[model samples]
Target: MSERPNYETMYILRPDIAEDEVETHTNKYRDLVIENGGTIIDNQQRGKRRLAYNIGKHREGVYVQLNYSGDGKQVGPLERAMRLSEDVIRYLTVKYEGQHSSLGRSTTPVAPMESSAPRQDRDLVGAAAAIPAASDDD
Candidate 1:
């Protein structure tokens, strides 16, 4: 089998849309991807959240995140549908390069090195000790 490229599509829907209508749209896109030869990895409804800045007159939007793997042919149709939908305030699909951080993947935290101490103070003290005291004869 060939290696398929992974992609993540995040879209913002109009906040005022009904919950059932949201489900309809979500299922529509999910089926669309499958029909276009893409396999869905994960689909998440991030729920309604306030936008950083107002998009048009709306202060909040329903967020949907879709992750899939395909041969890159499914993007055009998927994005086209989103572009034509009035309920979709914004949409973006990006080709995932490597390990995605925000996909609920657990990552080991990096521990601080044993020598992780402030060096500036030690350097300053050594520099002061190295310098000769000013003589009155000078």
Candidate 2:
């Protein structure tokens, strides 16, 4: 028997939807996954946020993310439902092979360290000084 693979689906809904309808939409997709033989790992409602660009005259959307595992068969019906629904504006599904993917894990990003040396001094000290300047001679 083949091992089930991990998948994450993120869909955006119309920001104008009611809270109850949002819950209904989330449950419908969750149930669809279960009915199609997929195991749910994580489901997150990321709340309403501004879109990077306008979609169908709207400037924002409701985001929902679903992480699950299955034999890859469940994707079609799930995506089809979103494509046909007026409530959903956009959606994407990504497959992960193993634990390398940081799904379901919360992590705080570390800030980058700043250099101690001054930028002007550092630029003139090494290879920058050895490079010849451009000339107009042909």
Q: Model-by-model lDDT, in order?
A: 0.88, 0.89
Which tens-of-lDDT digit does each residue in 60-93 have in candidate 1? Answer: 9999998888998899999999999999999999
Candidate 1, residue 37: Cα displacement in angstroms equals 0.3
Identify the runs in model 1 with alpha carbons over 4 angstroms from their true place: 99-138
- CA shift of 72, model 1, Å: 0.8
Residues 52-105, model 2: lDDT tens digits: 999998899999999899988989999999999999999999987654234554
Give TM per candidate.
Answer: 0.72, 0.72
| lDDT score, candidate 2 | 0.89
Per-model clash counts, in order, read 0, 0
Best by lDDT: 2
